[model samples]
Target chain A: MNSFKQKWLICRTVADVTYKEWSAYRTHSMVSIIVGPVYFMVQYFIWTAVYGDHPSLGGIELPQMIRYFGATALIGYLTMDFADWNLSMLVRTGKFLTFHLRPIHHRSFALFQKIGHRSLGFLFEFLPCLLIFIFIFGVDMRPASLPWTILSVLLAFLMNFYVNYTIGLTSFWLVQSGGLRSAFMLVSGIFSGALIPLDFFPHWLQMSQFFLPFQYLAYLPAMVFTGHYSLGGFELSIGQAVGIQAIAVLVTFGFNELVRRLAMKQFTAVGA
Target chain B: MKRYLDVYKQGMYSALQSAAAYRMNFIVSSLITLAGNILFPLVTLLIYRAGTSFPGWSLYEVLLIQSVFTMSNGLSSLIFGGVLWTTMSHVREGSFEVILLKPLNPLFFIVATTFSIDSAGLFLGGVSLFIFSAMHVGAIPVLYWLQFAGMFIAGTAVLAGLTLMMAAISFKWVGNSRISELADSVLHIGKYPLPIFPKAVQAAATMIIPVGMVGFLPASALLGRMHASDYAAILPCFLFLAAGIWIYRHMIRLYEGVGG
Candidate 1:
């Protein structure tokens, strides 16, 4: 129990360092902030068009649909971080060795700092987009199912951290995973409902939302405000979302450990 | 002209080598893009399932527009995907200096530096689907005689303008890459038949960014939803290309160098 607590503290310390390293520059922070909301606006425009003609596209209604996009937009900002880990490409190019000599868990520091940068970006960028959404739609900030909604959003973000981090680790094996990264980002958008509500997905695709971690990212919690996931469904969905995410994190860490050992061996041999 | 051709050749070769080095990733990226580009029709497909035209376009008419936009997108990225990194790391790292020191025009050299050959798969996928859809809608027209030429001019101008818009960011910021993602998203929107947007937003697509001119306007001209006089869009198209080059030249002076 004591050792577990120690590791947990170490993780937070690492996350904090990363946040500072990336967010230290005001200009860099501001540019990301500006881009996030503008990007969000284009997506918001897409949904508004789809809903303009019909009250419901797929089981989701107009008011609920608007709120779903609004909530997902905010929640996704917290999870859609990928840049720090992309440093692996830089590592291959010899850009990452400078950080390696530092006295820290290089991977954790790199991953967390990028998350920190993205978080600052989101706060500056998304806060106004959220307000603009509220102003336009008069969304009920208080959904009757607030607790589960919050829990699910947090779970969605956590699941994404693992999924995103593990994918970054692939750079160790692949010459360039940025291409794979692009594919992964686009796929997550579908799940996270960055482009369209998962509910609107054809029946087969929507079912995969259950099997994959995508539901946890965008759908289950989104349904919380949409009023689809009732009290009973909310508990089950949150449990599944968190559970799937936990299992995914474990599997990913397991993969990372095996890969790390092998990578170190290969890296050492090259040095020798 | 010979100098430009040689630059394009060297650029294309390195881009090919990058793809060759990472064949698996390259293949997967192309496949993934093919899926997203193809799947984009889903929204419009659902909308049109209600059974109506956008004043003059049939459902396939929009698909035709998507094919043109997507095909050009596929071709441009395949031919010049490397320019993307040049605007980011190259300039940020002052590798632009290596490029500038060469006798070649650094602008053309950087822009053609990396061809995303994988985008070829995407281009072919779009073209095949486009041809299939076009055939389903109508037999081949001698209009094909003019199709390739028309698409080339429109596509080249849009690519230059959009690439410059993204490159222009390096004037002030390092790692201004989310804007590149913005370019990708905007390209996705351009594949829409007429516009999937409200009138105001549609107007923005046309007037503000002029992306509509690239794919939709020209495709619309071929489809007869737009008259040939709409070809007047060609003026603005070239103007955007010129303006982008001018801005980039100015931005080049402001580069403080990649301190990071």
Candidate 2:
């Protein structure tokens, strides 16, 4: 119990420092308020042009599409982090050596930093954008089941962090991982349903998404908020979907741990 | 003029030599850029495959527009994209004064030094996609091709203007990397049919901001759909470039170098 309390305190202090550091650049984060709505507006025009008096296309109404993107933008603020970039830079620049001297593990420190950064994002980035989506765009911001949606989004946050952390770990081996990282980002953006709904993809690709962890990062939570859970041609209840997400999070955590250990072995501060 | 051209050629050659040192990285980075450029066209394909599309636009026509946008974006990045990073880094590190001490114009020096070899992927991908889409769009007369060439150059000018403005803002807004994203979101307006937008947006895209010239107008010319009013957008494009250059120069004057 004492150990757990100590860990909690460490987490809190680190998070506090992170929040303050990022707050200095609040304008950087606030750019989302402008960007999110502009993106939604573009989507609004495209979907309106596509629908053209039709009630729905591919079983998704225009209103739901609007809500999905709004939720996407809002949740994105809550969840997004540059763990991969952060960790890779540390590895590449020989900064990871500093972490080795610290009492806490690097990943734990990174997580604590993320908590701090995202806590600021929650206030500065997410809330303002939520208000814009709700008031300006008139998007329905309520989830179908608030409890389940909260659980799903929390899981998504963890899932996204772990996946990116795993990708960052690859910097241990590859001298120049920017290309690989960019490729992964593109693949994840598509497979994670950040760009468009997975339902829009061909049946084969949608089915394959069921087996990948990418869907839990964005699509599942967004769909749950919209009050429907369908992927890979299978429709599951919100409860069941969240349950699957929980399992995926655990699996991803385990995979990330394995990669982290292997990566640490490859660490060598060549120039530094 | 000859000096500027020589400077640009030397800068590009140096960048190429640097990239050649990391041959594997360059290849992979270029391929990844190509893959990213192809993603939107794939999205367009899926939209059409779902049996719907933008009004009055066939799939290939839309693809042509997107490909043109990609090429413009690629060329702009290749030529001017480095200005943003160079400015941001120099300002942050207090090294910006070094550039001011140089004999050449600051903007020209920065633009010349920042030529990116990675964007070759985006340019190549755009060329390939354009050829494929244009093939499906049917043969274009030399007249349309000529119009496309002129409009495309104008489009590139608009993008260069936007790039300069963004780089200028970094002078004051130090460490604000998302400025490019703001530009990107606005520029995305150009990647689709202009008719799909509201009248206000269309006017802003044409007369005011003129992002439409970047992709929509160029592709429309290629497709033989240019109206006489579209030619009105050309002047605004140059005006916007002039405004950007003026703002950039003003910002450089305002830059009080950061203290240690």
Candidate 3:
């Protein structure tokens, strides 16, 4: 019970520190807030030209497609993490030793830090963009379905965290993890439907998504949030999506643990 | 000029050696870079697959524009990457003094010190895509190839000039390291034909930001779509370089250096 309390304290302390650090850069955050909307503007134009008086394409009409991408932008930004970049730098410089001397486990510390960082982004970036979509773009967000959407979003966040954390752990063995991160960025951008809906992809590409965890990261939760995938819809319900996301979180977390243990076995501090 | 040449020769040697030291990393990074280049084009492909296309421009024509943009980007990154990184670090770290201390012109010294070996991967990727797209659209005449070569070089200059101008903005606001992203976002519009956009955006892209000079105009020439006025698109390359140099100098005068 004492150990559990200690762990809770660590999580709180790390979260506070990370929140403070990001909050200090108010202007930087403000600048980043508009980038998503700008990206959506480009998408808006492209889709308008593509649709060209057609009511719907790929089962998503114009208004719904706008909502879909807007949700994606907000959700993608909230779940994004540069932990792999940070972790790789730390490992390369032998700064990972700093975490060893701390009372908390490195992975847990990172998780808490990420949570704190994203909380600020959610407040400053996500909410503002959400309001923009509703007022400016006329995207109808079904806030009536908030409870399930929030739960699914939380699960999606956890899944994304584990996926990124696993990628970060690769720096322990790889000479440079930047390549891995870049490669993952391309694959995940496609598979997560952050760029476009996976249904828009050819049948083969859509089928291949079943083997990847990218869908749980953005696509499923965004769909659920917009009420595009409800209980009565052709897609799975909120409960079923959450169950799959939970499983993904567990599998990825387990893989991360295994990789961490193996990486530490061969770890060497090059400069230290 | 001879001294500048020597500096670039040595820079190329060091870049090669640095690449050799991290050969595995380089190989992986190159492959990933290739993957990233291919991924954006895939977005266009998927868009077309949904029973729609960009008006008046076929899929291959669109691909050709994007491929030309990539190749131009690759060329600029290869040659002027030193200027880009120097502008970044020199402002952020207050290391501009080092360049000022050098015997050669600061611009020349900055341009001569980095080879950007990674751009070779992008160059090859761009070339491959260009070939594929060119085949689909049918080959142009020999005269068009001559114009294509000239336009390609001019387009590269425009890319370099724009990059330098964006980097120069770092001097006034060193804390905004992300200033380059504005340039990136602007250049991204060039991957599509210019006419699809609204008139206001079209005007901004042509006159203000001028990303059209980088790819759209050049690709239009290859497609035999250039107007007489389109030949003057290369003129921005010179103007951009002049403006970038002037701004860089102006910023140097204003700089107080780190922790001042």
Candidate 4:
């Protein structure tokens, strides 16, 4: 009970810092806000062309496709943690010490801060555009069904926090994570359903997704909203997401310790 | 002209050296380009299977147009890769001044400074995929390859023009490339045959943004689907050459020396 309040205060502190970091641009924050939907819109535009030739595509008609992708656009953006900087960046620049100066645990701080950016960013940037798309397209966003949607979204939040922080820890060893980040984008583009649904992939790719942790990050939650999977499947996806997230958090913690001792022990502060 | 060659040679040498230093990054950057081209199309193809025969072409023809676009894009990235990100940095930091201070053409120097040799990977990916798609369409006559080579050069010019035009806009408050991002989304259209779109959309894509000129028109010429827009080639072809030169001058005019 005593430690719980301490953690809560740290989470609140990190959230404030993240909001300030992202709010640096008042109007231009729209760039990042539109990024998700615009990305999805691009996917929708071409897929619409292709589907124009067919009456139904994998059980998704034109309206459904548009509606589904629109939802995907909003959800994907909200789940993203752009603050997932390289641990190596912090290490190389000696910025991690700043985090150490505070009493907060680095991983929890990173997660909550990223989540704060997501909340503020989604509210300001994506919500208006998303609402417009919803009305313009007459999207059937069943309000009654939102309870499940919220739960799925929570799982997605947790999973992304794990994935971002975990992958960010890899920067400790790599020194500069720009290359790693780009590679991660390529992998995520396929597995995260940013490019296309994992269902569309060949049997082997779909099978491989079970072993790799990409599907739970963005794809599964979006699918739940689209109503592609049954309640049971959605539960399974959430379960898998929770499981993978736990593993990722453990790995990130380990990597954090490894660098804290082996690599970072050699560092002298430039500021000093 | 002699001075320009010397500049070009020095730029190429420095680029090569920098690229050699970051071998792992170069390889990964290449794979990123390849995966970007491949993944979405493969996914779209799944939906295409459920859709109509895709306006009159097969999966292979659609793949052909995309490969051409990727090749052109890859070529540009190879030539001006480093400077792609330079636009953001320059705009944000007001480094546009140093670009103006150089004795040589500022636009030329700015572009040459960051030659991301990472495009060599893209070039290879493009060629291999082009041939792979071509074989699926069947071995074409030798004249086809010659014309492909020529059109490819045109395609490269068009892509570079589009990107440079976008970059030049960065001269003014980062030029809200919202339009360019929307334009870049045309990669989906590029991956498909043109007729897949509504006639009006096709016409608009041709005239307004001239995206059709990048991959579609030349691709149609290759697949033997020659249409009026294929002749639209002469527009972006000469237009890009002329527009690119003008944009460079415009960027120079916008320069307020931060280089001191």
Candidate 2 per-residue lDDT over residues B1-260, each given as its tens digit:
99999999999999999999988889888988888887867767877888888989999999999999999988988999899999998988878889998899999999999999989999899999999899999889999999999999989999999999998999888989899998989998999999999999999999898899999999999999999989999999999999999999999999887552
TM-scores vs. true structure, each candidate:
0.81, 0.98, 0.91, 0.86
| lDDT, model 4 | 0.65
DockQ comparison, 1 vs 4, better candidate? 4
Estimate the TM-score for candidate 4: 0.86
Error of 4 at A42 (Å): 3.9
lDDT (CA) per prediction: 0.64, 0.89, 0.78, 0.65
Return the lDDT, model 1, position B88.
82
- Between which residue pairs do clashes occur in model 1? A18-A113, B82-B114
Specify the poorest-scoring 10-residue window by lDDT in model 4 chain A: A230-239
lDDT of candidate 4 over B9-120, digit per residue (tens): 8888998887778877777776776666665356646655544546567787877787777777778777765554676567667776766667988767866777767777
Tell me, by TM-score, which candidate is best: 2
Residues A1-272, model 1: lDDT tens digits: 99768766776766666666656564554443445455555555555555565666565665666677667766666666664256556546755556556666566665556556666656665565566556754665555467666666666666676566666556666646677677777777666565666655556766656556666667666666455652211234444544555565566556666765675454411221
lDDT of 1 at B133: 63
| Candidate 3 or 1, higher lDDT | 3
Candidate 4 has which clashing residue pairs, if any?
A53-B52, A54-B52, B82-B116
Sort by TM-score, top down from the best:
2, 3, 4, 1
Better of 3 and 4 by TM-score: 3
Cα deviation at B122, candidate 4, in Å, is 1.2
Per-residue accuracy of model 2 over A1-272 as CA lDDT, tens digit each: 99999999999999999999989998999988888888888988888898887788777898998888788877889889789999889888888888988899988999999999999889988999888888887878988999998999999999989988898899889855676678878898888877788888999999888778888888999999999988766889999989999999999999999998888788876545
In model 2, the runs with Cα more than 4 Å from the true position are A269-272, B258-260
Off by over 4 Å in 1: A1-12, A25-53, A83-118, A136-144, A169-180, A230-272, B17-25, B45-58, B139-152, B185-188, B194-199, B227-229, B256-260
